[model samples]
Target: MAVSFLNRERTIATPGYSRWLIPPAALCVHLCIGQAYAFSVFNLPMTKLIGISRSAPGDWKLTELGWIFSLAIFFLGVSAAVFGRWVEEGGPRRAMFTAALCWAGGFLVSAVGVYLHNLWIIYLGYGVLGGVGLGIGYISPVSTLIRWFPDRPGMATGMAIMGFGGGAFIASPLSVWLMGRFATPNHVGVAETFIVMGLVYLCFMMVGAAIVRVPPPGWAPAGYSTPVQPKPLVTTQNVFVYDALKTPQFWLIWWILCLNVTAGIGVLGQASAMSQEMFRGRITAVAASGLVGLFSLFNMLGRFLWSSTSDHIGRKNTYFVFFALGTFLYALVPYSGAIGSIGLFVLCYAIIFSMYGGGFATVPAYLRDMFGTRYVGAIHGLLLTAWSMAGIFGPVLVNYIREYNVTHGVAAAQAYNVTMFVMAGLLVIGFICNVFVGSVHERFHMRAVEAEDEVEAAPVFGGR
Candidate 1:
């Protein structure tokens, strides 16, 4: 019965539907789920709940707690790939509502786990359940927005995705404030804080679910027209989601995204630690925190700025800049740190972070270009498995390389030099992959007859 309420079609784009409402609805979901990035804020307190700065008997270790986040991200990729078709068939309203339930309810369940001092339960609640929510919520509006604003696909996706980068910015300070409010000397307040946050996000996500609506069939923006002869790499032909994965273009883009994310997110995962370690006593903990915040700001900024710019310069060219310039920045980081130039170090990392986000924001548009809008959300969901892979790969690679260097008698300050160069090499590989990304084969494109058949198969209904 509850499923019927969620799955029922609303079809709210009557005669006067406005596209402007869509971005806000997307922002609400992305902003809520994006809090996953700020999971680190809880790591310190969770470890020290039973004892200050260390774990006592029965307390979770830092390594154990880290799995909570890892599990969530792993499941996010899984759910996205598994449920991509469901999201397309069920529509955004259903997907967003389900995402809201899983995300909010996961928090409440994790609160119970915290209260019971059960680590595994916490992992199940926050990592497994909440990660599914993150996956669905992340892609909920992507296809809808691309279809609605076909003229500006890059900008449309950028607006929603940028909120994801910004979510950590809001969640970090807000979580600290909430924890402080609920804390006592004896209680770390994690359980109560989780409950409060869960409820708050539930309300916020529902607002988006209520407000969002898809366009009526065949609808397009005013004055917009499909190009008679599509530009290079831009496709008017739709491809099925499964067929898209079989194409070389998809795998090439996958390599591009994986490498780009690996290079940038590796640094992001270590930003605060790297700053303090590399600069010796010159960079304080407070200053390192500020650097993290600055990274977030640039990450958010680049999503919109670079994606919007993609409309003018083309998606391929934008990625050229990402790989080429990003490679240079990654290689330059160790040098900037070696010279003890804090400003140069920060500037280099900031640019790298922005391009990291730009890679995310631009790829949806890129997919739209290569695969067409019909199955873009599903293809995009499949492509995001790269992100899931990179999440583990980047941090582990950085950590392992640094540890190896330290064990070999290298000073802590210079330990990351090899890792930085290696990451730059990864980006160089990504640059080569991008060079091979061209138009999909014409044989793979959806036939006009097939599109008409699909349209005929869909049930007709009146706008609500």
Candidate 2:
């Protein structure tokens, strides 16, 4: 009730009754914005629209549409790194407000682009401008939420980032429904779709932003939490972020994440298409699209389930499971056709996709456990640039390697096998990085006695 623009570092109090409200508020925004993945639903329609508008309708290709979505993801990471510092300083509420504004505005901008038939404008609006909002909105509440629920950093982060994974779930159906309502064959319904979706997400994310606040200083979860089971810090309060940067731990985790994500994302970006290509008769294009949607279901569940499991087992153990288990499953995709069972293929793909989602949701807590939460948002933002990198490498590797195999006279079945092996090797390397995460030791971490935010942390959590 005391929420305002005042510097939030000062002491404030809320009844214990209010503590339970924060996590649900966090989930609301995530559930909506996570639809970024579902942008695929628009691919055919957008291409249809473009083909109709262009004099040479037959020349338009699906790859061109893929590029538009890929561009959006590439900028998502780029913008996150640029805005991370601001999000840290401004507090979650302020950061989410900016995200809502840019994201909604990007939709309106893209709507205009579509209405005017300017593909470049649409790209600029969604890819460059909206992507920045995606990045900022993604990381804004991470540090504050982790601090609030130290007992469940993995679960807390999973809950927040899970939005990114599940965004497509609600998006796919909604887009389909709206498409039916507004779509015409010669022209796409995208303008209206963008207008309606943008307005809806703007309202939804604003509600989330309004409800968002960091836990009061020195606060702890209602019951037991992460602090009680002691782990040594890697660096001291005296240590600077630059100093933490120098340690091998930082870069090691970086490569591990890069490899892990690349292996998974490569397959994920291609799954529906891959399914359609691999099993022509057993699954229709609609069935293949359903397979892709199934991936989201698994991806969303893994974020919550595996991350919560980390609360009990520790983060390293979770990554151990992901890399080791992921390595085996990823290696199976191309060769799994020996039996020729489509259901088997779907189940296998679902398992791997879940790990992909789990890896993302779990990594933040892994960082916090070793590094301390003082500058977690900035550090996590920097680390997520790995995703941007994955956004490039995953698709490129699969596309390039498969192209080579096709040119070499390798059959369609064998074309993807070698790439699958390469992905497995990458997972092996990630497994090693995680295994080598020696304790951070207190001397290596950045620390802070209090930000203005500290005025609130201790008093709120000090007692029951």
Candidate 3:
């Protein structure tokens, strides 16, 4: 009986329900799960768990700790692909609730792992369990928001996803303060911090699950009309989630997203180190840290601003701008360093980060354009495999290329020049993929009878 409240039938928005409330509900989940971006803050503290003041003999290496975030990201894509159809069928409330449990539980279990000094336990708890939570929470609100704001799907998705990019701002400082508050002579306070954060996140996420509601069937914003003549690339037909895999357009967009992300994510992870290395005496550790913060701000803002712009300029054109402008900016980075222009170097990366974020925000609307709204959430889930792959590919490319250059006696400042060109080359390939993202073939779309039967088999409550 208690579980029934989470059913899809119970979550349908009643007449006169305010759609404006939905974005905030999404923000609750996103802002919490987005803490994954700041998990690095814990890496150093976690290494000191045994020694308190410094590394002990048994302490986990930095390289081993790095796998925690990698594992989380990898599982995020895997779980999203595996469970996406269930999320679509189950409703946002159920998915959000389950994600909340897993997310908070991961923290609690990891706290125990820290207390026990078991790295593998931390990997299973935070990496696998928390990652599943991140995946579910991430997509739970996407299709709901799209349905509620069909007139401005890009902007709607951007509003929710922007929280993910912004979450680090809140989490980074909060984590630092929490550790400080809990610290003592023998304890670094990591376990205590995790406990507090977990409880806080659980409470916040529950609020989102409670408040979220899906639109009733056939509902549309007042006076908004479906276009009689759909724009180029915009489809009126729906593609089954699995069938979408068979479309050439799907793979093209997949490559487009993957390559774009690889370029930015590699650089993003290495931003501080790269800035300090490239500029040498001119860039301090403090200044480099500030640059990372700046990247976060721009990354967050671009998600909203560029995605909203896509509503006007179109998704394909938006990605075109990302690849075209992004490629030029990446190539410009080495020149910025060569001239020793800190301002230009920062500016180049700032713009690049914005488009990197823009790429994430714009793709959902793009999927809606080619595949239609039904199953877009599930399709989007499948598409996130690109992100998982890019996560591994990007960091490895930057780290390995830079190491190889330095080992070969390249100057620190000049070492990243080749890597920058390689990133630019990646963008060139992404641009070509974007160029070929035509509409899906008619045969892949669900027929009217099939769509009707499916809808009848799973009717939303208010439609009756």
Candidate 4:
């Protein structure tokens, strides 16, 4: 009976329950999982696990350690696509609870791997299991929020997704402090840190699971009325989740998200190193880290600001700004370094990172526009495969290109120039993808009879 509490029926919102409470519930899980962005803080300490102060002969290479984040992201997409429908049917509470377990368990298992000095165990723990948590937790609240605030779906989703970006702001410093507190002469303290963080995240995410609820069927905000005429590209008809994939609009949006994410993620992953290398002596390690935190701040704010803006300007036009402006900014980054202007460099990246976060926050509402809300969450999950692909593509392109250039005697300052142009070019391609995205055809819409049948057959919640 306790387990049944998480069921879809139980989660249906009671009459007069405030919809505003939903965003905070979603934030609880997102902020915890958003710690993924700060996992980089653990990299060097993990490498020194064997040597205490440096890498021992048998110690894991930085390159080997890099796979941990990549695998986690890759599996995040994979698991979301695989389990998305289940999340839709079973409801947010069950999905969030499951994610909490996997995420916390991952830290425990990874702590054991750290103690034993086993790379495979870390990968299995954090990469596979934790990644599943990320995927499920990431999507669990999206549709629920959209349904709750159908009048302002973009703002609703943004409020929740912004937590994902801001999670790093809290996590990066917390992880560092925990490691410092636990470090000893013979030990790096990573295992213990992981244990504590896992427990903390588990507690926070469980709070989210308990608080989340679904809007009852046919619920709408007071005084809200369906528009007399649907806006361009905004669909009222539902598309079955699988039928969504058959539309060209889906793949175009897919490429749009992929290319946008690829440009941003590459720079995000390498922000500290890139800043230090580009500015050389002008930017110290500490300064570069401060820059990273600033970027995270803009990243979080952008999710809320830009996505909320999409509500007025339209999602398509918002992405048009992202690609058009993003291309110019990416191209401008190297120029800032060449001119030795720290202000210019920081300003350019700050704006760029904001749009990067914006792109993520806006896409769910965009999906609702193209596919309708009935299966939007599941479709959004499948679309996240683009993120998984970009996760690999962006990092490899940036890292390898920089390595190749440096090996050939390119200065650290100039080495990223070519990569910057390449990123700009990718955004150009993304801009064109945006141009091709249009409304889904009527052929893909679920028939009116089918829709009525679905509502009739659906289980009554709260025994109504």
Candidate 5:
């Protein structure tokens, strides 16, 4: 009975159900999970817990502590892929509630781990458990908003995803403030700070869970009509989630995402160092930090601004801009650094960062465009594995390229030139992939048998 209650569908929209409420609920969850990006803020303080820049007895070293974040991200991709189908069966409420518990509990448990100085326990709490929360929380509201705003999937998903980018900005400062508030002479207050954040996040996530509601089946806003125009990019047919992988379009899109992310994330990983190297010590540490912050703002803004722009221009065209314009910007970066143009360098990187974020926000809508809405959430979840892979590939590639250059007697300013050109080459590849992407084949789309099967298996509406 409890399981049934938890998995119940909210198929009926209540009177005066406001779509505006949905974005806030999504923001709440996203803003919380997005804290993952800001986890680095803890790295420095955590290293100094026992002694300044040194580990005393029972203290966790930086290398050991790094696994906590890695595990979380790994599990996030794993759980999302493994449990994504279940999210389709279970309503957003169930998935969201579960995510809230895992996310908040992960924090609370990590607090205990910190207090006891148990490194493995911290990994279990924050990495394994929190990662599960992140995977679920990330996609929880995505499909619902797409349904509610079918005409504006780009804008809808963009709003929520923008929060994920902005989340790091908020949590970075907030975590510092909280740590200071709870610090003792001998302790860095890591444990107490974790506990407080966990509780606060729990409260915030619950509010979203409570407020979120699914639209009624077949519901559309008054006067909104489904677009029936035959466009090459837009699909009227539905595709099942598993079958989506069988299509060439999916793989091509996947390739597009991977390459774009690899290039952007590589640069982002090197942002602070890259700025200092390019400017030849003219850029202060404070200025470099500010540059990083500016990158974050551009990333967040691009998610909303560029993705929303896709609603007017087609998704393919939008990506064209991303890859084409991005290729040019990347190629220009080396020249900008060579000439020592700080303003031009910053502007170019900022725009490229925005395109990076826009890619993330626009993909869901792109999937919906090609594969249809039947199982877009699941498909999106499957696609996020690419993110996990790119996360590792990006930093490693950048670091290796830079290291190779430095070892070969290259100057610091010129060290990243080859890397920039390589990144531009990647964008060029992505542009080709984007250009070749077509609609899913009809054979892979939901046939009569699958549609009938779905109807038979679907839950009863308005059930208590």
Candidate 6:
């Protein structure tokens, strides 16, 4: 087994390292440890503290928290792209080390800000510092895993990336429990929570980074040197980022990602608040909280379950489901109740939620297929800018449009209808794009890939 993954003759001379188990190890930390999204539970307590200190609800707003998240996302891409180049230059081990430092350090710094009652400091810590960590850590395993299991790109990357999304499910609950222990009405013990979470994640994420390593060159998976399925007209050869970006397929994917992220993030940011707004007259606070928890459960499951489904269905078809089913679901959200059922609304959102989650897990494999795996981490980094853009558009659209309706005499129930309709429109456009996606044409195939394969095929200077 070991011999299959190593250079027995030491001829080609790319270092031999373990690749098979590392991706899941990286994802274990990504999924189990990255509960940062659940950072919202800390928000109300922080808000209350700021409120007690004389900040207005609107001024010390939860929306401000959105900025922190948005900034983090903005930098996540920037960091990944900048650092991905580094990963290419050095290796996953080096990249993961950098990621670990920034991750923990960001938290430690943010804890100081919280203790000092300085929001700006907290922003700097979590947004700038932590986001850089996220970017590095996120892409660390992608190219490595793709290299190791060339046969199963979708399943490999999906398993780890899916964990990043699902990490919050467990973290959110644990965080809430932690906050409860540390919180006071005037001060939610956020400072301590930051310190503790930062410490814990630092340790966990670093372990992941520490464990990862690259595979030997020219080696394929045990049973998969020549793919059982026909290699797409595409291969990773001579492919470069600039060339891949030039293709129509790239832009189509970009738009699809932008739409997918925009719809889901808009809903995610406002899930708890939306629940409260919807049930203001009819449901209690406890019930609303329960609904939010249910939403979180579904959101986390969608990452694991939906992306795993893609392993069997293939990336193109998986996205076809996302864009098509998601559009229908978005359109249904507004009228589900008036059409006589809350159950429909719940079901609609749930499916939309899964599509949003699946869209993320599917992309790495899709990119590896169209472009070569050589620069996959970098290409993926570049692609995440779409998510950053959506991070801004999704929430702002929901907020601004909903506010306009309320100011112009729309009832609270009707406030989000316009927004829902807009989301539905966007999903339709994405569906069309997904429908058009196919394997890249041969003209676009990279030159380096061909040369590399040709070199490997030639008779060795001495064999057997």
Given candidate 3, what's the lDDT at residue 289? 96
Per-candidate TM-score against the hidden true structure: 0.96, 0.90, 0.98, 0.95, 0.96, 0.86
Q: How many clashes in each candidate?
A: 0, 27, 0, 0, 0, 5
lDDT of 2 at 291: 77
Candidate 6 lDDT by residue in tens digits, 64-116:
76667667778887887676656543456566667777877888898898777
Model 2 scores a TM of: 0.90
lDDT of candidate 2 at residue 435, scale 0 to 100? 79
| lDDT for residue 310 in candidate 6, whole number 0-100 | 67
Candidate 3 TM-score, C-alpha based: 0.98
**Of 4 and 6, the candidate ranking higher by TM-score:** 4
lDDT of each candidate versus the true structure? 0.88, 0.75, 0.92, 0.91, 0.87, 0.72
Please provide, for model 5 over 366-444, each residue's C-alpha lDDT reduced to its tens digit, 9 standing for 90 to 100: 9999998767887888988888888888888999999999999999889999999999999999999998998787888
* TM accuracy, model 1: 0.96
What are the candidates' C-alpha RMSDs? 2.5, 4.2, 2.0, 2.4, 2.4, 5.7
Model 2, 1-464: lDDT tens digits are 44454234431336463655566667666766677787777777776665655434543367766766777777778777776656665677777778888888878898898788777887888877788778877887787777777777888888877777878778889999997788766666888999999999999988887676666555676675444446643222322334557767777778878888898899887787677767767778898777777787898889888898998888889999999988888777776765676777788888888888898888888777666676677677877889989889998998899899989998776677888889999999999998788766555643344433433342332210
- lDDT per residue for candidate 4 within 1-464, as digits (tens), equals 98898887888889888999899999999999999998988999998997999989888888888889888999999999998877776788999999999999889999999999999999999999999999999999999999999899999999999999988878888999999999999889999999999999999999989989987778889999878799999999888888999999999999999999999999888999999999999999999988988998999999999999999999999999999999999999998998999999999999999999999999999999999887788899999999999998998899998999999999988999999999999999999999999999999999988766655444433210
Worst 10 residues of 1 by lDDT: 455-464
User: lDDT of candidate 1?
Assistant: 0.88
Better candidate number, 1 or 4, judged by lDDT: 4
After superposition, candidate 6 runs with Cα above 4 Å error: 1-20, 48-65, 182-187, 228-238, 276-283, 441-444, 449-464
TM-score of 6: 0.86
> Candidate 4: lDDT of 181?
97
